[model samples]
Target: MSIYIDPAVALSLRGYEMPERLGFGTAMAPVMFRAVCQDGCWSNGELIPYEPLSVDPAAKVLHYAQSCFEGMKAYRTGEGIALFRPEKNAERMAYSAKRLCMPPVPESLFLDGVRTVAAYCANLVPGNSGESLYLRPFLIGTQADLTVSASTSYEFYVIASPSEAYHSGNMRLWVEREDARAAVGGTGDAKVGGNYAGSLLSIGRLKERGYDQSLWLNPADRSSVDELSGMNFFAVIDGALHTPALNGSILEGITRFSLIDLARNLGYKVVEGTIHIDELLGQVASGTCTEAFACGTAAIISPISVIGDDGGSYKLSQVPGPVAQHLRQALLDIQEGRVEDHFNWMLSVETVEV
Candidate 1:
């Protein structure tokens, strides 16, 4: 189906000004891609002037929290503008929708929506290293009903923002023992709004304690480390890489798996298994674990400087270790087109005649 572009989109794109500081998600594109699904049938997408949404006060998404979102990026590559692992984001969005009992946006439609936005807003793709046009694709149940059932109608939107890396320098994390962000056998693994909503209080409390983010443990046992509020956790023990194994509560981050593959390819021993919180702390204190970091699409790789708890603060021997630095540069090289994309992860988007 052909995508329709509103005539006003051109005017909006022409009149927009680039922000001096393109911090994460602050500089939104002037045009947006949108499509509606009614009774399980998806409509043709349209590119309209970016404006405020008209969500009903009693919509299911407003009351029941029936929404899912994906975070992906478009980069200025050797082949012009391109997207990084968009297919992975599409597949993950489908998984999140199914877990929420909402109708999944067809994969073809999902791709078309993102591509249309990126193609038209190609000029928004930043030229700085580690900067790109961040794309946010979301689905919401739109039926205005007060009942506790899935809405029959849904709205899908693709929006773009020219942004730099989310979290740049080393970070301090708090060991959260009292609040559980996600529970086992729940929507922990799914990329939904509710999962993130449940984590706000923990992050809020952690900030008061002089911590940057929360290190959440497994809700079932409350002993093994699961993940951070929005990113996956990783540690460098001795000379190898260790991360928590998938236990249905940790969102399988695209950047996390890509780093695992990129690390193994670069001759590093990467292990995915359960990491006990107390034991890991002891290892950090004893200098057995030298470095740690968190990974996600927005914050590619942020080194962990300290892990604080009721006991005390444990400082990493190296704020940014050799291994973390090496991997981060290697991944950025592939993303920014400094080197060949041996992994074939980028999907090039044609620049539209805007």
Candidate 2:
């Protein structure tokens, strides 16, 4: 389906200036892509000026938390603007919407929303390494009713940001023992707002203690490693890569999945299994676990420096170990067009003329 470009969208794009400080996801693009749905029928998407949404006070999303979102990037690759594994994000967003009882944006519509935004905002795709156009595609229940049920109306919007790499540095993590980010059979696996809103308390508490993130344990057992608050976790033990196996509660990240495949191709022994927190800490102490890191779309891969709990802090011997450095460089090389895309991951977008 052809995307409609509003006249105001061209003006917004032409008048806007790229900020000198391109902090990650802070500087928004002047134009956005939007599509609406009512009674399970979706409208054609539009490229329009980015503006504040006039949501009703009694909207279902405002009260019942009926919202979901996906994060992906548009890169300045060898073949112009490209999106990395966007289909995975589209699939995940569909799952998230279904979990919240919201109408899933059709894959075609999802691709149109992202591709149109990326194509129009092609000039805003930063040229620097570790920088790209960060695309945030979200869905919200728009029906203005206070009743505790799914809304008949929904709005989907895709906004872009010219961003530098999200740099968390070598992170310090706090083991969250008191609070759980998501429940066993709840919306834990979904990429919904409530899951993140529920985690802010734990993040704030950990930040007070000088930790950068929370290493969340499994909600059911609370003994095995699950993931970080926003990113997936990985640890290298005895020269092997180990990430927690995806259960019902873990949000499967696209970056994590890509790295697993990339690491295996690089001849690393990749293991996806239940990683017990106690055993992991013990391995860290014994020098078997030499390095650890977290992966996500925003941060890419951030090395973990320390893990602190009520017991004590366990520091990984290597801050940014060889495995992490190798994987990060390999992934970035593919993303930035520095090397061949052997896995056929990137989908190039033609720049749309104003």
Error of 1 at 123 (Å): 0.6
Q: How does model 1 score by TM-score? A: 0.99
Regions of model 1 farther than 4 Å from truth: none
lDDT of 1 by residue, 191-258 (tens): 99998899899888999999999999999999999999999999998789999999999999999999
Consecutive 10-residue window with the lowest summed lDDT within model 2: 163-172
TM-score of predicted structure 2? 0.98
Candidate 2 global CA lDDT score: 0.94
Superposed on all Cα atoms, model 2 deviates from the true structure by an RMSD in Å of 0.9
The residue-by-residue lDDT of candidate 2 on 1-354, one tens digit each, is: 778889898888888899998998899999888999999999999988999999999999999999999999999987798999999999999999999999999999999999999999999999988889999999999999888899999999999999987865899999999999989899888999998998999999999999999999999999999998889999999999999999988899999999999999999999999999999999998999999999999999999999999899999999999999999999999988889999999988989877
Backbone clashes in each candidate structure, one number apiece? 0, 0
- Report lDDT (Cα) of residue 16, candidate 1: 86
